[model samples]
Target: MHYLLRRLGFYLLAAWAALTINFFLPRLMPGDPASTLFARFKGKLDPAAIEALRATFGLTDAPLWRQYLTSLGHVLQGDLGVSIAYFPSPVAEVIGTGLGWTLFLAGSAVIVSFAIGTLLGVVAAWWRRGWADSWLPSTLIFVGAFPYFWLAMAALYVLGFTLGWFPLGHAYSDDAVPGWTWAFTADVLRHAALPMTTIVLVTLGGWLLTMRNTMISLLGSDYVNLARAKGLPSAQVALRYAARNALLPSVTGFGMALGFVLGGSLLTEIVFSYPGQGYLLVQAVRAQDYPLMQGIFLVITLAVLGTNWLVDLIYLWLDPRTRDAGS
Candidate 1:
């Protein structure tokens, strides 16, 4: 309990710091959204329009501290200001449009890859020198050696463009209606398959290698030897004793991967034209959409911190040593 409280306090502090940074970083940049919009229009509007634009964007000539407090208050109210790239649209709404696609694409890929890779690692380590142990790691590493964008491009060209096995991009077909209907769901899955596969292929090797190394090291530990000597079932000893301890490092990695799910695979999204956060981020940067960018950054920061805190909680459950030490 004490341990979790301490961790919760730490995360709260980090989130506050993140919020502060998110507010100020964009202001420190070369130009504000109002100026960027004014430039785009070639200043044809009334000169006073720039001030109106600034005001709409929640920008002010007040002291930095005052502006910070106002921005913080707006953030707490879920108002991230109007986006420069998407004029008249609130930053929150723009992000809301893409957040679901990103979570479905990147989130699914992370969970699937983590499960498959961790299972493979456990199997390979439990049967050292066997077929899986000898073959799986090298093969995965070889495939994973290629960059994500490179693989995405290759897959897109071959499977999507040339072979026409999958749709070219986007979360669903243009004709597909957004709903709970099976047709829409299937279309969404079909569109997601290529990019999701690319992400999994790129990330699987790291998880597998980490788990395999940890499992192998744990297999020789005294606890494992004792479990074996006590005539425990081979599967039980391998899983309940060795694999559990080996999973700690992989859990940490999985948490980080899960957190970044909101960030999406940038290059993969670009190649596939997926309407996710990564593509949105590109649009934000290209248009100098400060509010939009800051909103995205804040979301990603909170995600990372939140997932890591969850991982810490899982650690307390999985390993008694942590609880004992905390006590």
Candidate 2:
């Protein structure tokens, strides 16, 4: 509880800081939102319309502190204000439409990668000095060092294009609708296949490698040798003793990965033209869509903050040593 409370408090503070920074970043940008919008119109706007636009975006009238408080209040209510690019539509609405795609693809991929990697790590550690330790690290190193975007490009080129096995891009075929129906689900999975594979391939290696190393280190500890000498079954001794200790590090990695998913595979989304938050952020920044950008930034900041709190809880659960140590 102590550990969790400390982490929770830290996350709350960090969230406040992140929100404040998100508020000021756009104001500090090279041009104001109104000017950027005006540039698009290619001419001067009428006085009445110009003032109305400024007021609509919360830019013209209110004191800075009042505006900040109002913005924070709207965030708490999940009202992210109207997107400049998608005028009259709230930023939340724009993100809501695309968030499903990001979560379905990236979230699933992260879960898959964590499962496969952790299992491999356990197996590799248990079989120390055997093929599990030897070949696994080599395999992981080969894959881990490959740049994520480049690996994705390779997957697209070979599997998607040349082999003609998977899709080239998009979440589904144009005819597909968003729903619980078989068609929509299948379409989502089909479109997800390529990006998912790329994410898994790139991420799996590091987890496996880290776990294997931790396992090797754990196996050498005096307690593990004692457990083995007690005539315990090889599997029991390996899993109940060595593997459990080795997995603690993997837990931390999994927490970090959870936080990262909210960022939604930025380069990968751009490369595949996936309409996830990451790609939308790119467009928002380019057009100086302050509302959309702020909304996305808040989502990511909250995600990271929330994930860290969860990690602290997991640590307390898994390692009793942490229970009294931090308190």
| lDDT (C-alpha, whole model) for all candidates | 0.90, 0.84
Identify the runs in model 2 with alpha carbons over 4 angstroms from their true place: 325-327
Tens digits of lDDT, candidate 1, 1-327: 988889999999999999998877777877778888999999697779999988888787988898889889999999999988988899999999988888889989999999999999998899889999999999999999997788899999999999999999888988889999999989999999999999999889888899999999999999999999999999999999999999999999999989988885788788999998999999999998888999999889988999999999899999999998877
Q: Can you tell me which runs of candidate 1 are displaced by over 4 Å?
A: none
Residue pairs whose backbone atoms clash in candidate 1: none
TM-score of each: 0.97, 0.93
Estimate the Cα RMSD of every predicted model relative to the unseen true structure: 1.2, 1.9
Candidate 2, 156-232: lDDT as tens digits: 99998999888888888888877789988888788888999889988898888888789888889999999989999
Candidate 1 has a TM-score of 0.97
Query: Which ten residues in a row are the worst by lDDT in model 2?
Result: 30-39
Error of 1 at 321 (Å): 1.7
- In angstroms, the error of model 2 at 297 is 1.2
